[model samples]
Target: MSLRWRLNLLIAGLNLGFLLVLAWLLVNNHRESIREEIEAAHRVTVQMLGTAAQTSSVFGPPDTVMVAFLQSVGRVRANEIRLIGTDGRLLFGSPPSEYKAGRTAPAWFAELMRPTLDATVIALPGARVEVVPDPSRAILDAWDRMVLIVLVGIGFVALLHTALLYALRHLLQPTEADARRLVATTRELAQNREVTRLIHAGVEDERKRLARELHDELGQSVTAIRLVAATIERGGALPVSQGAARIDAIAASMYDSVHRIVRELRPAALEQQDLRAALLDMAREWQLHHPAIEFEMHLEGDLADLGEEPTLAVFRSVQEALTNVAKHAAARQVALAVVRGDAGLDVAISDDGRAGAASLGGSGRGLGGMRERIMALGGRLEAGELPDGGFRVAIHVPMPEGAP
Candidate 1:
């Protein structure tokens, strides 16, 4: 259920799967090696029987020799040597197969050993000799060796299990530590962001109050000054008229300055229009400040019904991004896109500039405010350089229910 346990299980499963594969390969290889060794032993046994056949021929009537040789072979329970004419009567050779009652290996063991032997019959002076494996002693020999190997394999597997357990714990220990560190870092970041959010909210409230005071109080006073100056200019001496005109001009300039302040405090475009118009207005205004930059914008789908927080977050995010590009990127070309999808709104602002440069804003460079604003609105923001070239700022804000 917990992440650490799930991760450990995943890693352990993979390691165990690898061990099982190795065991399968080792078992198959061991089985093959045993089979080859058995074949080699059979060849050696068959060769020995052929040599006895040749040695027995040295005698005039070798039947006695053959009988002695086969009887000796039976005692060893290795190879069966037999002699019989066309009549199928026992002429002169080893005893019957009843000699091997309890001496044989179990049937399962025999089949597993699976000796591949064939009878090599030779023509002699009087009768024929058949050379075939007796198989009891040979199979028992192989079974004993195989059992030793099985026990060793079992011990090896146990050793491997212990080593793997230690190794997994050792290898994953740092990773687990790093994960815990990361979780702590993320928690701290969230707390800091909450504090920043509160600070920004208070600062924004102050900005609104200042803008209102400048607009209502200072603006009314300036308007009254302009009215009095105009009246004085209308019916006065020439010098007084010129002085009043200059006074009226200063009043007008001050009013325009205050209006600009109010507009920056609470963006008028966002107030008067929806997200689409607001974003375009922000981009167009930015372009005015940087006439050298070739800026482009693409707005897709309907975005009018996106509510207060979403619209404000999107507009402010773009506004900040373009400002960064204009001030730092030295970029000649830039593009902005806002897409409305079934999931949410997606915004990307990018510039074709020297990427990875100091000006690309590794220090968060005012984009930190943008990120905090987006995150507070249930959106995500990513700012980095594109692989091919240039820097990009991308944001995705999920659409709430009943959103247009």
Candidate 2:
């Protein structure tokens, strides 16, 4: 059966059993009290009749007055009135009856009392009286009433209990539904943000690759074609020809412009081979461009062991920092430090240039990009102006296990 039915039945059964026992006890006690009262009344009537007999003997047998008083008492105070002779013969009473000593009661009276029967006997002057009735019948009637009341009370309690459980379930349903909806919405938003970030990073990386290829490969081809044209116009070193000389000068200027453009587009040495060697080459190239600027670098780490993403991020951040220094900072000295920690790698770039934190962002979104990259790898980035009038950028990245 369902829980509700089971609960109701259980409570009803318990209450029924308890009430049945209590009702039986109460009914038994009440019946016993009625029986005792009846017996006491019978005894009082017998005593009064015995007293009247004694008074009649003192006066040598009662006259009309004593007979009238005895008849009145028998009618009002006794449930059974009997007069019997010493030989067991009926004397006078309604339904005159007699019983000899050691005789069985009639079958009809025995059958009338199926369960409990009581009998009380009293003696009169040369007569006897007997009272008989079943007391358990009254107890059974009281027991029936108690059983009805118990069933009604148990039914009411069951209804109330069912209503309480239903209300509690209803209250929980809405809260559970709201919690599930909130979790789903939060998950969707997080996925959307992650996808957006990945797309932006991929787009920027592809654009940089294309710009490098355009400047390095195609620009060189154009420069070579211009030089060839100049050679053709010179006609094998024409003597005293200003036109040929001017064309050669123009071709030379164009070559220089092509070289500058290629370098701006891509650091070719960076893609050539080992990143450490590439960084060294970049430092040499920068020194060539700005002879007045001093460069100091300390690289002590297993640079070959860094993951592809981390390696590229470090290279790009360093390149951007140097570019900022060249474009804005007028200081003469620059320092770069790279190290491999226990779990990852660290880099610090400092410049002793006139332009400090205030001038670090002359061109690129240098620090912002660096921050995003470092955060992606569970790392940290810091940038500030140095005390000696320049800028500093520091980065720490937690690397993969077995990484240098």
Candidate 3:
């Protein structure tokens, strides 16, 4: 009715078919073996009868000897032995009469039973013909039993296969439930985090815009006003020299504020050079800020050449890692490695801080943002505190096809 049922049925059918075929093959093989054995035994008996005839003159009357000989052969061989007199009366041995009453042997078996090439037949002193019951009929009967056993085995195997599928479905039900729940939870968490990240990025962009406006528009107005005030102070417009000097001091203060605002708008170094040069400059600035911590950077490969997105992701990842290390890792030395390979690029930032893996978990949102940025660029980011004490971030970015 359902897909699961159909799948189970299909598998069961295949298994049953295999079992049945195997059973038939085994039955056929057994039947052939039995037939060969019976035929061989028949030949041996014929040889013994012939030997008795040849030795009749030396041993005694062959008729009496042959009667006992035929009986012995019948006892030894699986097939029934029959000695037909001239009138067709069986004088020595015969098969069960019930065998004749059973289903008639097929034409093929009957034809095979009709004797072919004569075997070594022993003659009694009085002369007699020896006949044996068809080995084919006996073999067929054994084969029929074998077929029945095989059918039964196949049925058992089919039952086992069906039961196994049923058991697996039942066992996997709970696991399937857990998987669905896990998927749901992951989706919800991702949506919430995505919204939060977008909001944060928007706020940051807005701040940069405002800072640019302040530096460009407001700073220019302030500079113009300061120039006017300096001109007035230089022209001796103010009665007191101290008052004019105060105006100059205020103008200088305004100029410093403009410089600070311009810096806040964006790092000037980033605009002047590419991402590699920019990162190095930022590292130098970070080291200036955190003089106690040692910063080491090694740039290998062609990182300076990359798409805007990938380059930006790398730059931000480095920035975030360093920022995180500064805030969380109370370490002495920091190592930043950027390796660009043919496949893509790798950036690893490690610090010899007191924080280990456990400490990095709740260290804050910087690592999460770094991870998201890398992920959005089709890269992977791994962040954890190193075992030997300190935090480390490893990032991998896969290059586009044919990208060198």
TM-score for each candidate, following the candidate numbering:
0.44, 0.44, 0.43
lDDT of 2 by residue, 1-404 (tens): 97656665765676567667765675456556556755666566656666665566465434333444545654423245555555787554433223222343344422432334354554545555444433233333434454566567567656765676677556555587698999999998996686566558657965896787667756765676666567766775534465456666666866776675665556565565355866776777778888898899999877764766777778877877887678778868889898877867889988887754443442235666777677778988888777767888898988778654
Worst 10 residues of 3 by lDDT: 113-122
Off by over 4 Å in 2: 1-273, 341-343, 354-364
Position 52, candidate 2: lDDT: 67
Residue-pair clashes per prediction, in order, are 0, 2, 2
Q: Write the per-residue lDDT of candidate 1 for residues 1-404, one digit (tens) a residue.
A: 96556766775676567666765665456456656665565577667766877889786566667766766666324556667755676765555555435566667777765556676787666667776665665566656666676677666766776676677667766687798999999999997976677667757866786878777757766776766666676765446766667677767777776776666556676775488877766676677778999999899989786888888888878877887787667788999999999989999999987665554443453576677678888888888887877889999999887866
The parts of candidate 1 lying over 4 Å away from their true place are 1-238, 359-362
Q: List lDDT for all candidates, in order.
A: 0.72, 0.64, 0.69
Better of 2 and 3 by lDDT: 3
lDDT of 3 by residue, 98-183 (tens): 55346644665445433333433344546565545355556556556665787788778878886988887877566877989999
Steric clash pairs (candidate 3): 49-122, 50-122
lDDT of 2: 0.64
Question: Which pairs clash in the backbone of model 2?
Answer: 331-353, 331-354
RMSD of 3: 14.8
The TM-score measured for candidate 2 stands at: 0.44
> Considering summed lDDT, which 10 consecutive residues are worst modelled in model 2?
94-103
Which candidate should be chosen as best, given lDDT against the real structure?
Answer: 1
